[model samples]
Target: MTETPQVTGRHRELLDQVLDKWSLHVLDRLCEGPLRFNGLRRAIPVVTQKSLTAALRRLERNGMVERVVVSTRPVAVEYRITPLGKTLQDLIDALLLWTADNLPDVERARARFDDASAVAGGE
Candidate 1:
């Protein structure tokens, strides 16, 4: 049997960082190959420039992403997933599968909750 590790405040903070809104998107896209700033932004259309920048910075700080600068007439910067980041691909895939499998149930649950909230508000 596998043992569960103790969870600490620091662990929660790092978990929050790793699983935030844009982190997975950034990491998953980088998994395909290295992409320049504009390319990454284009891949994730809903993300604002500021949000993507911040997510990239956080991932870089966490040692999960690498930033490389290409020197040309006009310099370019690219981001790639590190070895550590690639390790999470399985987890990401699992999460994607789970969402696909359970989407209908989740939608039903959400509709039920919304209906309950509306009924309560009316009462």
Candidate 2:
């Protein structure tokens, strides 16, 4: 096993922020290309409009995403993953692979734990 480096409190906080529920979903979709607000919402149908807006805003503030304004007839906004965000693609891919590989095991573990808990009257 590889040794893990110690992470400072601030580092952990940032990691949690960047990996928030909606942030990863937004990042994953944005990785494909720049997406308009509605496009992102359509792609990630599970996320609410407010949640996606908040995630995009947080990403833009963190320098991981860029917001562009198009001077069109109706005016348009687009969000794209930045180079900083691109730097995390490898890690993201690894996370995706790990989840895919472990999902079955996770479900089995959950079932076993829940069965044990219910037997003990722990709900």
Leading candidate by TM-score: 1
Please give the lDDT score at residue 64 for candidate 1. 90
What's the lDDT for residue 98 in model 2? 96
- Write the residue-wise lDDT of candidate 1 on 43-110 in tens digits: 99999999999999999999899999989769889899999999988998888899899999999999
TM-score of each: 0.91, 0.89
Residue pairs in candidate 2 whose N, alpha carbon or C atoms collide under 3 angstroms: none
- Candidate RMSDs in order: 1.4, 2.4
- Badly placed stretches (over 4 Å) of model 2 are 1-4
The CA lDDT at 103 in model 1 is: 100
lDDT of 2 by residue, 1-123 (tens): 999888999888789878999998888888889999999989999999889989988889889999999999899998999999988788878888999999999999999999998999964
